[model samples]
Target: MADIEVFVFAVEAELEAMDRERVGVHRRGRKPDLALRRRLVGLVWTLTFGGMQWRVAGWLSGIPFTTLHSAFARWARLGLWRRLGQRLALDWRLACGDEVLPSAVVVDSRSLRSAPSAWARGIDGGKLIKGVKALAVCDKHGSLLDLELYPANTDDRAGALPLLSRLAALGFQGDLLGDSGFKGAPFATAALAHDIHVSVSPGGTRDGCFLPSGIRWVVERLFAWLSRYRRLNIVYDRAPDLFAAHIWIAMISIISRRLVAQTHT
Candidate 1:
């Protein structure tokens, strides 16, 4: 692993960028008491590696457990996760080149089992299995170009449009390919409006199609990278926003690794 200080500096830069975009402010909030941030990063590293509890994190960082817990909650509530996700995705595009522009791009979704605390029961829906589905778009190098997350029961197809829209916002205009689940015309028409061609696998025909398998696998590979962190493997935080922060933190770590690789190359 790289030096923690280098990781901290990269995170601090990413955080500042996120704060500016999400909160309309770029203030560092009293220098974050570098000592505190250092300890916080340590805790994150522990939880990320499937270590002990917050108390253990505190003991390791030499800070009170409650303070660490409180800070984690506060940052999560502030949409740090989404910001981190955006930052990592953007960084990937800048470092690896955007495949969605003038080339074929892959779109897909993945289902993850939910934590007990994350379960949601509806009045008429009954107690259904709780989980989340994430939609991701990526280039050939496993670099995230776009992504979105929603309740496990949410239609995967429904999430596709938002991810597509995100790509558009980032100036991606090209061909998109997906499985048959995205058979509806809405997404096709949406892409068409942007001059993007749509290719969907046909039903009952598993043999042949214009497969963008190689490009599409990049997003799945990114998910694999995310699962390397335990905090992201499960929705331990009751609040969605907090769960998102951990996700972003994990992404930042992956992007940092990629950045290092690029510099050496």
Candidate 2:
């Protein structure tokens, strides 16, 4: 089966496992059938992967434009994408015989140029990019644990604390691995506030590519995987949360396939 087919099937399974209220699918009125609902889900993936615009989803799906886009935006606002990402991360860990809560998290940021339509664009003097920064936290196996997006000018140490705190709220207790950008005592002290110890990967990479001793590089791989989704290459959406929602969707698409592939392997 195609990867998206697997992803859709996995999403359907998750929907089945969930209560109707939790998944946000109501049975009132002229509800779309299973096949139609599946198509709607696929249409959502299409809209996300295509990055055309939200208004086009109705034209693509033959559903009312407002209805289509509102549902999509509402899910993001309601935190469905975030919830799905966390659930899949847990399932991925279990499939790979790993723990549900990661023992170690690798955090990093990427700067991408924003489109003229995007908001709060800033310059990252370090990366020299005129855009926003995406802060990502992933486990040793490269599953996304949490994420945040903000203006590129924001300091990495400052932007990452909230993500770590979110994990900590979920009972996460682990070492935080990162590049030297996260090495300062201020950031370490801040991370310790959440009970997550800090461990920066050794000195500058001025010598060459810094090959760490552990899974620090795995988060880079996660970033690379996210880069493949055409929707994520640039910040086109006006709302940063919507853009972040796409990131979660991309991870769901990738991780769901891994789950399916494991069954065959």
Worst 10 residues of 2 by lDDT: 23-32
Best by lDDT: 2
Error of 1 at 223 (Å): 2.4
Q: Which clashing pairs does model 2 show?
A: none
Query: Candidate 2 regions off by >4 Å?
Result: 16-18, 21-35, 55-57, 207-210
Off by over 4 Å in 1: 1-6, 16-31, 76-81, 92-104, 119-130, 193-197, 202-214
Per-candidate RMSD vs. true structure?
A: 4.8, 2.3
| lDDT of model 1, residue 153 | 65
**Model 2 lDDT on a 0 to 1 scale:** 0.81
Model 2, 116-195: lDDT tens digits are 89977999997799999999998878889788888999999988878867988878998998888788998899888898
TM-score against native, each model: 0.75, 0.90
